[model samples]
Target: MHEPDYGVAGRTAIVTGASQGIGKAIAETLAASGANVVICSRAQERVDPVAEAIDDECEGTALAVECNVREREQVDALVDATVAEFGGVDVLVNNAGGEFVAPFEDISPNGWNAIVDLNLNGTVHCTQVAGEVMRENGGGSIVNLSSVNGQHAAPGESHYGAAKAAIIRLTETLAVEWAPHGIRVNCVAPGLIQTPGVAETLGIDSEQMPEREEVDRRIGHGEEIADLVQFLVSPAASFVTGETVTAKGVPKPGNSMSEGLGLE
Candidate 1:
């Protein structure tokens, strides 16, 4: 096994959306670093391969559960399965989410509710349930995946942006509320990265190659994001809580577009 800052050896973790992309990477990394990990996505078959692959390579135990976090029953079972297998959860990564980009007027109630339920309500369910277990077993850490879009609104993702923004506030609130119980909550708000979902949304082609290249050349990677997450959950970050750690390439300029374009 690889040496990791997190003496994650034997620490049990539950990472949502762990079938692919950023969540997959986080699960794999955590397992490699010595944490017994429980990972879930909505698909059992799809996630089973990831769990098997992780178990083969990492020192920690891995389990893949098919859980649609939007459903409370499944989310409860996901947590229950983890506790049954690993004894308890030490880290919870709320990484399962989806987005629907459309003109605000064109967004149907279904579209809006789905995003709200998965991103915001899903986080709520997982954190609430997992916090209860962690509180009983002893306190733990929660790392939520928000987005930079939450901080900077864009053309067609009003719903996604709103949900992500709420995650930031929710992180802060959970930190305060759960602190007394010995749990720490933090959020990671990432800028553009070359993930499948992101690429698909951008109509990724030669025209978008420059943007993708720029992000690769400047922004973060799934592994790097996982590294930060490892730190935030480890004792190294005991002092850090209720903070929205932005993982953008540049320090946010803090200036409005109007100011930059001289429209002000």
Candidate 2:
């Protein structure tokens, strides 16, 4: 198999929700690949460390901004700062997102709104602001992070899944509308991957890591996800717009019960 190269060097990219998890990974990978990357989260302190780490490793410059993407004003300022720092934008990764694990019935208005404001609305605000700069620059790439729960709803993830699903639709719509402006918008929905959050949430460690990686599972690696993201933002995927690329591992054909072996 031929390995893909994500040609993002010298290009300016803004990654949101980049203080930790997949967002942080994406920022690091982009920086390593030679992109003039800027990242933001809810606070500058949290993102400063991330920026420092990237600066220590990346071939290009990294900037950290304090931004809460759920608000349009913050997103606007984020774009302006990025433009001032790097001149223009070439890639916009709308990766700042989270979910609340509550049953559909238990999802209060405020709780549901919080999840949507961050996941869906946050993405929208970033895309709008970033797209403006990218449109002015002729063309750019926008990679929206989604989830399998959006495709196959998992219990207690109602708000999260719905927001992600809307993102898919938004990707398609924006792809069509923005193609004329020379912008390519796409989505990447990842399967269960090993992250500190997952491990801590489930209270599992090395001993259970392998068990969770059984043949029938759709687990994946963070680096693998980063690789795909790198591809999407790179010139290699010039024709890959309006698509939702799933990065989950192969799911077995057997039923859940068939794959169940923890008791054994």
Candidate 3:
């Protein structure tokens, strides 16, 4: 019997928002799988140390670039730098996004635009830019990061939910359009993953989280999401595209949105 192959060894990948949290875990996971990874964040100083750490600890190479995915020029530069350093792009993970707690009526126009820009427009910019590289290089895989709020009602995150929902639609459309180019597009909608950002926002610590073996696991870890991303981008999931894998643990009865957001 033969074991399944990840098919990521020696390939080149780009992971955005890699300075911390789930993005950082994805970058580390991919690099450890023998894929030369380009990790980028809006701040050079923040991402540089992560790149160094990955270089020292992982099996593959790591390149750090400062890029805000909302900027088209910056996204272009990021892809160019990746191609120059790693020769070509085989995988692109759009993981840069942000949102704040605000009810629909309380959300200002500026706030709405900001969340949508970062969460939706950012994904668009990165996907289009890196997707071109993939098109030219024969084929590649793209994994988009969304949120479970996209699929369900988000009481205090209306803008975020809207943007994330758009990403899911975008992924499905892009998958069909890019199929002829040998490019695959998919999305991951994570639910309550324990990351630095989540810790700070929700005041939930790792020690407070339930264990994986718990009968009612409510929260998840970044590494768990990273593993899913690795499989999606690797050949093991070659047939998986235009799909949004939601990693939220088994839902509990009568859990409110505010409770999930840690407002309870």
Clashes of each: 0, 0, 0
RMSD of each: 4.6, 3.8, 4.7
lDDT of 2: 0.87
Off by over 4 Å in 2: 1-5, 200-218, 252-264
State the lDDT of candidate 1 residue by residue for 81-166, as single tens digits. Answer: 99889888899999998786699999999999999999999999999899999999879999999998989977799999999999
How would you order the candidates by TM-score, starting with the best? 3, 2, 1
The whole-model lDDT of each prediction reads: 0.86, 0.87, 0.90
Which pairs clash in the backbone of model 2? none
Lowest-scoring 10 consecutive residues by lDDT in candidate 3? 208-217
Candidate 3: residue 198 Cα off by (Å): 1.5
TM-score of 2: 0.89
Report clash pairs, candidate 1: none
- Summed over model 3, clashes come to 0
In model 2, the number of clashes is 0
